[model samples]
Target chain A: MSGFTVYSATGCVRCKIVKGYMDAQGMTYVEKDMKAEGKEDFQKFYAANRRQIFRGPEGVEFPIVTDGTAIRQGVGACLAYLYAGRELDGFFSAGTLHKEWVDGIHAAGGNPAAGEKFLAVVRLLKGNNFKLVVDTYGRNPALLEKLLAENLVDVAVMEVMASAGLAGAIFGQPLAQEDIERSVALVATAPEYRFQTTVVPVAEGGQARYLTPQEVVAAAKLLATVTRSKKNPYLIKLYRPVQPKDERLGELAPLPAAALLAYRSQARAYQVLAEAEKE
Target chain B: MAYPSVYPTGVTIYDPKKCWSGYTIFQAKEAGALLIDMNGTEVQLWKGLHGFPNTILPGGYVMGHLGLRNNAFGMQDQTDLVQVDWDGNVVWKFNQYEYIEDPGEEPQWMARQHHDFQREGNPVGYYVPGMDPRVDGGNTLILCHKNLYNKKISDKRLLDDTIIEVTWGGDIVWEWTCSDHFDEFGFSEAAKNILCRDPNMRTAGGGMGDWMHVNCMSVLGPNRWYDAGDERFHPDNIIIDGRETNILAIIDKKTGKIVWQVGPEYDTSPALKKLGWIIGVHHTHMISRGLPGEGNILLFDNGGWAGYGVPNPGSPTGSKNALRDYSRVLEFDPVTLQIVWQYTPKEAGFVHPPDSNRFYSPFISGAQRLPNGNTLITEGSGGRAFEVTPDHEIVWEYISPYWGKQMKMNMVYRAYRVPYEWVPQAERAPETPIERIDVAKFRVPGAAPLGRKKETAIEGTKPYQGSTALCIAAAEEVDEK
Candidate 1:
């Protein structure tokens, strides 16, 4: 149980490479060729695992590497877990989270923390036996607002970004500084609403230039002043490249350790400013 | 006692009761009649002597030959090349009569012009002229128009047959004649004479012939010998199967020599022989790559041929006949020459009476490996065609409602499915609307002729009026004679 079991078939190049890597890392494991021995037993195990994790049957393929508590169905899944340096046993054993739910959140740029939070909310609602409903942004907002007023959902996770901020980034229409102030004022009326900003590095010329830490801090302070809110909102800096195919972005160096430290310091300073304003 | 179970891929039984009339199209009976669209309904495009029924390729185009019949004194069959659109319009046609001649003698054999027959003046020759014409790449026409007769010739030497590549306008672009390279009498003289003496060797029921009669031609890709850097995956090669010799050969179009061959050197490997016997196979087609069960050769293994192994008595042709009851689609690895996959009715969960048997006749049947991983096989003798899935389940079945009789013979040579897209927009017809008529209200015409005097045959019927019944009886007698 301390070691791993790598179920593979003969003539699979990927399986050989994976086993070689494990050996180099001094990890002991049991190897099984499903084709030569225990084909039916392996199929039964595979089907059982699939039913537990996925609602439908998974395609039958070789090299299902399992560490007693966790199973990786194919090479792609194995590689992803190896890079993450974490086992999915806890999440799977909980029986409350599905792989598809986690994958969907990840696809939409939601982090692991957000995924856990969403699962927790779903569990709470289900335990209460409430008929929960969810809709996309394009759905009728008035109906959603009505449901919210009726106290149908004890908690709701909604996505909100400044319209002016998005239009400026996507359509190259620069918004005046007052537009940002006005947007904050408009959303401040809703007590449950939270403002979210995604920080993406923009490439200009040959170097990736992120919004200066001082500028972010100043914006945060100004927003708090206009909205008359005391609590600093959560700022999630998503680190995906703005343009996938831009060669300049790839050439640019990572954020220097010193620069990252400075950014964190500025964020802390904004938190202090909001706290002081609340007092 | 329990028998070992064989699991099928899947089975889907189609019930006619749940089906609705989809469409109806009429096919003409001309020699090379093509399906054409007239007023939105499919009609045959009848032109100069149509002979063979059209064959549908992966695309919608139908390819077949045009000719009357092969006989001496120029009364023999001459092949006319043709490609018909789905709506039965002749998109292209080529006439080879000018270059071919039917010398006054015995029935001019179509095998004479094929690439496996020896040319005239060769010590041994088996040339039966005017045989099978095949079109490849929608532009090139490969004709196996000759045959050879020589006993001592090695199977490879039978490459003397000519495979002519002509354009749509009848221009011979390139030609490969087998006689120039291989010697017809290269084999032991005894083997040569025995093959020549058997005049009926090429016929289906004749003893095995020596000469490899190239019946079908397919081009693989451009010649790598001429242009080593040619990027095309398929080279310009031709596939010829000798019906009499039971040889499947691939001839290099450029060199006109046997590049690769199966049979004559075929042996059932220990593994395959342990499972079952697969003797003579025909209508070999290359299953397209990347499809389910791809990279294997699909063939109609007429297991009835009594060549190398002990013949199964229950074969379709009965005992003592080479073609008996065994027929199945076999997928074999071309390189390893191993039978990898097969489908028989028993494996598909169909139980038949002890007397019912199925087998393939090379000249009379066609098997198409379809894109959906099912095989469309035409049981020519029974005049039945069925679409079978990978699991050997019959999803679609059709019995030819129109049976042709040649001198009181009921035989179906071949049938092909015309994909709806291939028909030209102007040629396709709107679907025929089905209307049901009550049979009880139907009446027999009073003017109908009867061949004999009316009798009180029915228990409730009285005798017909004398003069009228007499007149009807006389009219029926005249019609009967």
Candidate 2:
């Protein structure tokens, strides 16, 4: 018996896409249309596993696939699982830069085991000559140092939370200022690397204000110091607080493109790159 | 990133069997108070009755404000607090609190009410089986704004919070102002200095210091603690939380003194460490006597930013000092401060840290304990309301369909789940089970294609070791510059 069961609904373009992708891959599976002949069966299935349902902004997504061993809700999550271990253009790995400290960060409920697994995957990709991209907060200097020394990562992006002094609060954990400085220095040594910081309104005393241009320049100065060059690339991306999540942040008007351009001009010590302006 | 403009609204998911099914009422962002059924049907709408948060009283009566005050002279002031019958006729009203005059507008009596108020019968504004809010008689506790200055708390004119108990005849029989208890909060010298200088100063009302912008207030009602001789949890004592100061306190009804409290400093205690720095909190109250975890404090820890403290690197002046990225619904023993139960991203079945924001509402939200073991949460910032079982399974969910014209967003201040019988004006809709739609398969017509090209390759490019264009958009952004 084929273990795959795709619960789809009629008129669902994603259903068609998922089925088409499966057919393109020569995979066989049963397609049950919840809005059509398979409605009753889907209801029964939903009743049995309602708690496992993942409801998004729209509703329960369609083309839910069950492989006997696992259930995948979205097309992206489903295909990623089905294509696991299959060849791809490259591998993207996170949670590896701070192997040990990953367990200490409470904000994301740190998982050292998961960090180890991610590091192992990076090693597997690099050992097999596959390209790798590493995105990190750059909290752990020694691990980053090792990763850069081994030339294991092709492209590395360090999300600079703040200048050395203010980073601990943003990270939700304190680190020696020297450590943050060292991580920036290590990331600078990568074959391809850039430092990015999302400019958001910092609320204090019940009011909010965006990080001043001088503050942005202070970050650029950190990059300049670490790379020992005025040409080190620094990106200032505007913060977009997703609703219901960072709605309070959403209430604050975003820094206009003109304001961002002003920051870029002020931070002349580094190659400052601004995010795409909101239309 | 641009978000999808089109998505499902109204009742997205409903499991009637698991939910404490009843009429869900809230102030729609557009105008008027809307009472929606379990299936998202509009059972009734009181068109001209606005709500900072509307509450449904028994016998088909709803209480809200008549209209809002002009922003030029007031921050969140309402014209009057009124109770309207099923047909939207004003039954009981109170507006004799303060008479205000704004330049270019006629001077009139204003209630100055903003966030919350509770009729005598129910301790919390929400419904309890045996504790329905009296429709005709009983005192009402109103959270109102009063512009004053104490120089002790701030140098600027302060938009201070004051709780008043008015009789059925609109007489202000009792009153308690927040600034009187500033020293009770145990602020450090640095915190005190910062507060005296800023006090959460705002531009509203021509630059007023909105010190201790208290967002929630409720009575203790009859509870196990008071029954067991805890005078601090006296049935009549009031509970209030300051959004700007990070303080949840209970005021003695008789003495008007703070009898019990938490914060301004949360990191010092072990019990507080369980739920760190509940900044910008709301809807704090003792769960009514009959509900689960009765006598325990239930509050929405609106984790955004709040508090006063010493200068830190992130906040140089220590104004609005505390911060957290996610929200949590906490039920804790007010005395021991032991967290009894909570709902965070983990309970919502999302991984922590990364998916934390999936369960956040930084400001303006609330929670209510249900008769069953579930808790109804109003994540008002997103205009989302839902009931979750004690195990944190979301049994029913509703997203507000009304978006405000001026705000251009649907943001509910608070929502309450009341028994269906409370509003007899409309017949209860069928408790149908609305299954969660497959968001993956759900689509808006004329939307972008669901499938991308199998290969988005830059053809004939020279290869380099470990080279991949994962962030093609970022590359484009750099090229644009």
**What is the C-alpha lDDT profile of model 2 across B283-351, one tens digit per residue?**
898899889999889999988888888877767889988878789999999888888999987688655
TM agreement with the true structure for every prediction: 0.41, 0.59
Q: Which stretches of candidate 2 lie over 4 Å from their true place?
A: A1-279, B1-3, B446-481
Q: Model 2 misses residue B426 by how many Å?
A: 0.5
Among all windows of 10 consecutive residues in model 2 chain B, the one with the lowest summed lDDT is B466-475
How close to the true structure is residue B439 of candidate 2, measured as C-alpha lDDT? 83
Quote the positional error of residue B35 for candidate 1 in Å: 5.0
lDDT of 2 by residue, A1-279 (tens): 245789998887656666776777788898889989989988988888776665545567766887776666544334433455222111221122211111111111223334343344345435544445555565556656656677766776776754554665455556676776777777777788777776767765666777777777787777777778666657777766544466335347765543564565456535423222221
RMSD of 2: 33.0
